[model samples]
Target: MNAKELHDKTPDQLREELASLKKESFNLRFQQATGQLENAAKIRAARRNAARVKTVLNQKAAAAATDAE
Candidate 1:
């Protein structure tokens, strides 16, 4: 998912996406620990995706705060 796609989603939707990404990250880590992870690249991708979601969520929160002010 790209920033443009994430930007179109509401905060609630973003939160849900973040949660799922985190869950996936956890599973990836577990697989790695068990020496079953086939693709290490997925871990990096999941981390980056989570970061993107967090960045967007922060942007939305800041915008809301500014609007409130």
Candidate 2:
């Protein structure tokens, strides 16, 4: 998913999405280790997607903190 999509989600939803992405990344790694992974590039994509979610989450948190101040 893209940052634009992630940005539209609430923090709780973003967190859930991050959790699923992390799980998928773990599974992808396991498959790679066992030589069952068909596409190595998927690992990279999953990581980047997770990172995007994380970035958006952080940005939201920062904005909230600034507003609170």
Query: Highest lDDT, which number?
Result: 1
Give the Cα error of residue 66 in candidate 1, in Å.
Answer: 0.6
Output the worst ten-in-a-row residue range by lDDT, candidate 1.
1-10
Q: Report residue 52 deviation for candidate 1 (angstroms).
A: 0.2
- What is the C-alpha lDDT profile of model 2 across 1-69, one tens digit per residue? 778898899999999999999999999999999999999999999999999999999999999999999
- Model 1 lDDT per residue over 27-57, tens place: 9999999999999999999999999999999
Q: Considering summed lDDT, which 10 consecutive residues are worst modelled in model 2?
A: 1-10
Superposed by TM-score, candidate 1 places the C-alpha of residue 23 at a distance from the truth, in angstroms, of 0.3
Evaluate model 1: give its lDDT.
0.99
Off by over 4 Å in 1: none
